[model samples]
Target: MDKRGRRRTLSEHVILDAALALLAEGGADAVTVRGIAARVGVAPNAVYTYFPDKAAVVRGLAEHLLGRVNHDRFTDPSQPWRDRVRALALELRAELLAHPGSVHLMLGHPPDGPHTRAVRETLLATLADAGLGPADAADASYLVNVHILGSVAFEVAAPPGGPDVGTTRFRWGLDRLLDGLAAHVATGPPR
Candidate 1:
């Protein structure tokens, strides 16, 4: 409602941006519908007009962040498949690290959104191209995704005493995982 007797206007993008800002400022707990509406200068119920509930808003924010991942770097065919996979992981890790407050909200969430789906597809395809069968590729992709999520969550939550030890650890862990995948491919899995 306004002086002109019109209801306050609120777009999905505006609501999502406000929610993301709240998430960046105070983690997932701060992105309530009421809070978003207030941030957008609308009545509390106005946010619901776009997002059904707070969970929906959180999902939107996570998807929004995932959508911003640099997929091009991972899809470049000129690079070795392993390097492509590693670039994807690093880019995703960098994004998650950039928003430490939002890591908790995103860590265990399903990758059903479009952007997350794209990343998943690319990862699986890369593994498949590197000689992994369908089952192996799917399994490996899931493991990689889980590793990135868990690793980033721990790095974000770690006590502020280390001088970026997580970076080395991440590279080491990633290389080990890739090595395991390479070995599996080389050994051709027992028939």
Candidate 2:
């Protein structure tokens, strides 16, 4: 039964939606089982029925947010590898920036859900297509992930003069990273 004394259907999605709202309103710490339950008009235990605990709620939120990122643009074989990489980074940045309050959830608890894995796989394939061997591709993917996550974290923490400022900084850093990767590829496997 909801707060109004009428029975309401509750599901994981509903709970996650409430949690996300709380997170957006007051950051990660605000997303507790009780808080979510209240938001969704359910008892606190009802939240646990869908999520075992707060960590599970956080993970769900991370996955929910990651699911919003569009990685298809990066999977286009016709596009240049650098362009594909940039598309992916931009997509991730856009999603993270859209939910600035949830950036810490992403940084603190990386999601290993299907959406996250698909994005990672796309990045790995992009690097491989760019001539990076498996090992180098894996390392390069890590570097790219770190850069995107770190940059978004900074932008969220201290918003630049404007959206364009952060976008410019992000593009510059991404370009430099790609430049190094390109040089590495051109040099062939380390002697």
Task: List ranges where model 1 is wrong by over 4 Å.
Answer: 1-8, 162-165, 189-191
Q: Kindly state the number of residue pairs that clash in model 2.
A: 0
For model 1, how many clashes?
A: 0
- Model 2 segments beyond 4 Å from truth? 1-4, 159-165
| Global lDDT scores for all candidate models | 0.82, 0.86
Q: Taking the tens digit of each residue's C-alpha lDDT, what string does model 2 give over 41-93? A: 87899888888888888888888888887777679888899999998899888
Best by lDDT: 2
Error of 2 at 52 (Å): 1.2
